[model samples]
Target: MLATRLIFVLSVVIGWTTACTPSDNSTSDIFIIGDDGPAPAETSGYFINHFGLLTTNLEVMKHFYGNVLGMRLMFEVHVTPEYSVTYMGHAQGGRNGTGFQTGTEMYREKNNLAGLLELVQFNVTDDSLVASTKRTNTFGHVGLIVPDIQETQDYLENHGIEILKRYGEPIQDFTGLIPNAFGLGEYAGAHIAAKKALMEAQGVIGIQLLLMVADPDGNLVEIQQQEQPAGAV
Candidate 1:
């Protein structure tokens, strides 16, 4: 009887120790409590094609991005007398050996181009229908990478583009360009101050050079110099 009791105690101790020990499985290996089952198969061959912007003046935007920035016009569609859409990108031609064209042909070959800028315009006569001036309250800015930042800066200056902030300039110098820099509620004021402090710190540490310019529509555009990797093509 003593031998049987000792064996039972040992088995109970072993079972308790095993139950108390932490799992060796990884966090991902552990199944979620409410998960239905395995995740569905992911869709393939997906890529970000382009970013669109609604502009009050399409021709001016076109001239700034296409002529000044040197983005090739991939396609242009005049949907109606007052409504139009234009797609522009850095690429020149399609995969089918055909040059970029306007209207239907360009629409058909649009899938071949990536990183495009789509500008939409609606020339409505009603004051209520027109969009207000470009506001930084929602969308921040559009970023464009250039081969040489200095040359690009000089080119923009020559074209009379408003330089909100030049390369290496202190954030304090361009505070006016930021909306509500002076006036903000309590939380927003603190947030902006913190962001400004961080930006200044980064600038002092010699981070990547950045140039900011305002387009004809007063939309901010960030310009950065492209840095190629060691073995990049």
Candidate 2:
């Protein structure tokens, strides 16, 4: 069913085309046929390397994702006196005996690790560079798979992390939160209702238990406990 839906969506996208004359160095109009465009030099072996978050406070974000969420600190680098980057992930092994490396060592073994979350921080005290509060209608959320949903919820609650949505909670109304694009804003209520129905159905099947919590920077983090396969350990 999922594959069928994906194929239908892809077919619709590929069948549609738009003609536009870009105001660049081009002299002719181009018809964009879905994802068709100039071929890249290397067209294969591509994957999502990592997700990066611009943080106001690196230490606070690190403590939230590391100590609270159990992601290991893979590496950290202080690029300059006012700038730093930190990588955290579920991958095992780090450097020295501290279970993390610094500097350029992480790039050497990048292929061996996956699911890294990069946190970048600029230590300048400029108010323009920092947001006073989190943007509520930004990117959706980062999802993490956990072994026990109830336990994860309890842990996050104990840590005083704000719980956006608990298990079996009704999907909140996001009428104006969604951007008014492609007529999506008008159907926000219907969309949320559909999502809530799907969630209830999935929960009845015991396939997944979900919890959504806010990180230190008010970013949403979805924690899910999925049913393991038979004899899986």
Candidate 3:
């Protein structure tokens, strides 16, 4: 039954392409099989953690992300009346971590994970951005890692932000995409296109932060932010 359904959907998706006509109607196979299982991966992973900004008060942050996004909260921390942290999880905390924060009025301005953004809310210097601006990626933002990328993409579109597909020259691979000069950059690889495609397929939406450069600590920190609509904003 599932195979039949997949065939029907594929026909509609591929416009009933003639190439799909098989030499045999056997349900056992359609494409060549490789004995090798899934692709091998890097030992550690590409990122460490993802951080973001919330527009609402600290309590609101807890209510929406915890109650609404359905993300599990590993822990919560307090900085001040304006600042708080509610760490969210898609899985465990080793490789990738997602969380929420409300203190300095940071708004995420993008729709995909640029990487983990180290938010600096404490004003240890003379030029800290305490006041939130109308349109800025002040502290930083994080993207929701959705398995059904198309679902997320649709959700975002319905909300209002236009999704843009970027094409890379030569369709760059790992070497071209990673920051060659930095050891970590090379490890991270060129996944922006992959992530964008996944997000589009899952109908992805919500805030995405952009990372233009790495911080002095050799970490890629906060850049920009984007908020989801239909109330997640």
Top TM-score model: 1
Compose the digit string of candidate 2's lDDT tens values, residues 1-233: 98875665454333331223345635432232366775676966665667888887788888988788766676788999888888886543322234445334455566666567899888885753322123333355677877777887888889898776686564443443211211234444568654434333332333234567667766667666765444222
Q: How far off is residue 186 in model 2, in Å?
A: 11
CA lDDT of every candidate? 0.61, 0.59, 0.36
Better of 2 and 3 by lDDT: 2
State in Å the error of residue 202, model 2.
10
Instruction: In model 1, state the lDDT of residue 187.
Output: 23
Decide which is better by TM-score, 1 or 3: 1
Which pairs of residues clash in candidate 1, taking residues 3 or more apart in a chain or in different chains? none
Give the Å shift of residue 121 in candidate 3. 9.6
Report the candidate with higher TM-score, 1 versus 2.
1
Candidate 3 per-residue lDDT, tens place, 1-233, comes to 97875655554434423445566754332334478765568643454346655333345444444453344455555677545555554323312233434222113311223333223333233443322211122322233444444454455456443333221111122232222221212344557654333233222122232222222222222222232234322
Error at 91, model 3, angstroms:
2.5
Off by over 4 Å in 2: 1-43, 93-108, 125-138, 175-208, 228-233
| lDDT agreement of model 1 with the native | 0.61
